[model samples]
Target: MLGFIESVFLVLTITEFILGNLVNGFIVSINGGHWFKSKKISLSDFIITSLALFRIFLLWIIFIDNLIIVFSYHTHDSGIMMQLIDIFWTFTSHFNIWLISCLSVFYCLKIASFSHPSFLWLKWRASRVVVGMLWGALLFSCVCTMSLMNEFKIYSALTRSEDSPNMTEYSRLKRQEYNLMHVLGNLWKIPSLTVSLIAYFLLLLSLGKHRQQMQQYSIGSRDQSTEAHKRAMRIIFSFLLFFLLYFLSFLILASSRFLPETKIARLIGVVITMSYLVGDSLILIFCNNKLKQTFVAMLPCECGYPQPASKGPFAS
Candidate 1:
């Protein structure tokens, strides 16, 4: 039964990874298609396309890492592949988080209405703000990855001299370096999380105000614009929920490192982490009309997926 479960887990993980890549690839392809037809793409499309690209690479690293962990448990050595995985994982994961936050801020700026001078200023400079955020994310990710890679090189060198006369000292130094690097990695994640939290809070405030204003109007008097606002609010809430679940699962996964014997907790964490890309992309596709239409058309006829009629809840 234990073996059976592990096999099932591996299969599910690989399946989700493949599905996520396909979905993200579809997103990138469609965006590319649009760019080819039209000379320009919107800022939202630019962010979404770049986000999908990062997620594709991230999912690839995750799938490879999970395969090694699950199928090659006897391999205790941390070699160059592991080092690459650590660096790429850190870079891609941070990049993905930052992009999501940028998307959230973009949405809030586009959807929310506020009379404050700051709000007006932000609304005017939303494009520049997103571009700045993207560059900042890239710079931070690069720094974190390079720092980790440097530590990893030292760790790898120490690992190679396991049988040396000073083996004990080397091991101690490696452990200390690893711990410091881990802490630094966690520190690098702080800004992304802070940005995301701020965006989420601002979106929540906007949604609340919009809801209250809508409530003042009669249902019979609500227009398409009101419906669009409600749809945007729902997408923001859905994204927030996804991020909350992801962070909770990430904490659990990180703690599992200390409880090496708790395979179940680690397994659950891996599964949740792997699902984030596919799950979030699905949310985005369903919320966006163009992506939804393209995705639905690509589905097999036997799947019985209904064509979306108009831009509403499930329609897009």
Candidate 2:
């Protein structure tokens, strides 16, 4: 039953990934949603959409692993192919966490400039620098994980070595290397996740100060500022929930000595992962009245396009 739910969330997450990308893609430069002469993609736009792209790629890799596990049932006997796939997964997970950390920091600086829009000029240049570094680090981690790809054991009553019956001496040693890399892979997650969360809180505090200054303005301006702030706040919490649940999975694994391991760890992991999709989607669903009303107004025509005029409190 728990696996069934995670499966559903996996589907839902991919759906979000696709739709969000389409939104980021089709969003026109002009406010009226005309395709004739759309706005050019600015650096900020590229950076923001890049974050969604990162999430989509991350989820897709994890989805592959989920499929492999379900189909193979953890037999753990695939050769080089499976080993390489595991390396990809490890690197993707690490890359996703760090990329999102940079994103959180980017948002902090972005929001910090509510008063001085010129401040974002530096971010435009910084985006390229950050993206390059992120790719380099991800590649480095991928190479490191490959070092552990060949390490595995086939323990049996008659088996004398850590190597399997069919595994060669080189394969056996490679397996040892792979095992070591697994520990190192997980070790990186601890710092990556910690950095991501720390950025979240610092960004939140920066936003709080920004909002306070906006409070002195007219109701109309203040209301717009409030809406944007709330949206950012929701995003911060949504990511926090995603990472928090993931961290708890580690604790669940550690508790295996005193508690049943597989059932509880897996069941809870499913719950945590699903909650991210459900909760984050709910934030978008509840907040985006324009998206909802647009569909309603275009019921007999092309549905899901933005309405000609939206009365959403947050609509610009």
Candidate 3:
């Protein structure tokens, strides 16, 4: 029997799962089809496709996790399975964050006007730089996964150990260790978040400099470079907005573990976390020119009216 909040959470999760897959699948199919036909993909499309694919997997993992929680499927014997799921979740989540940071870096290097020799060097080899970042992120995620697995092993061993005469003390110590490990696992996200913030600030600086130059030269406000900078900023800003929300949801979920009575907070966290995928994908679609064009083309028309071509929702 589902309680009211559990029922609502289930409904929201299902809705988000369906919506996320639809949007993310659209991204993959469009980009993948283009790649298949042309045998090449733009670096932006490649990153977008990869991010959408991982997000699809992340959605599935979150959906299953929510189901487990709502249904109380967790049991003593299910520990190993739950741990495996957690590892997969961690890997995908880490990649998602790092890939977003990589995208920010890519946009900054490609669009920003930076005069530094290092910036010029990176801009010339942007593809290689982005690819290297992806590989580095992969290696780092693998290390985190391994660390989590080791922690799980330690926790499992502790769980199986015989109870000491001071049972209460031993139980308290185990609980503390579990909470500590959870916090440490989440702390791994900070480095990627820092990278994203730095990239964002650099882009903002470049935008400001470009605007000042335009003003000094009396250049038109609707020039290509200005539009490019604005578009990139919109995309990055949307990413940051949803990423922060997702982070907040994680905090709420973590707090719910400590305050077991706050079932509503846990449910809300799960809903918000799942919503991030759908929200971010929709933002990408509207912000990216190719994606927005393709999405508009896919819509049905009525009354014998031709659909207007999309130049991106964020276009000036």
Candidate 1 overall Cα lDDT vs. reference?
0.74
Alpha-carbon runs more than 4 Å astray in model 3: 73-78, 161-165, 301-316
| lDDT (Cα, tens digit) per residue for candidate 1, span 229-312 | 566667667766777677766666556545666565656767887787889988888788778777777778636456544454
Evaluated at residue 61, the lDDT of candidate 1 is 82
Candidate 2 has which clashing residue pairs, if any? 29-39, 148-177, 148-178, 150-175, 151-175
- Give the range where candidate 3 is weakest over 10 consecutive residues by summed lDDT: 307-316
lDDT of each: 0.74, 0.50, 0.82
Best by TM-score: 3
List ranges where model 2 is wrong by over 4 Å.
1-64, 67-71, 113-133, 136-160, 163-184, 211-223, 249-316
Q: Name the TM-score of candidate 2.
A: 0.57
Q: Can you rank all candidates by lDDT, best first?
A: 3, 1, 2
Candidate 1, superposed: residue stretches over 4 Å from native:
74-77, 153-184, 211-221, 262-267, 300-316
* Residue-level lDDT tens digits of model 3 in 1-316: 9988789889999999999999999999988998999999878888889999999999998888888777774451256767877789889988998999998888888888888999999999988999999999999888888888667766775676434554676667776777677766777888888888878888899889988998999997877777878888888888888999988887787666577566677678779988999999999888776777778777785234344343432321
TM per model?
Answer: 0.82, 0.57, 0.91
Q: After aligning candidate 1 to the native by TM-score, how far in Å is the CA of 25 from where it should be?
A: 1.7
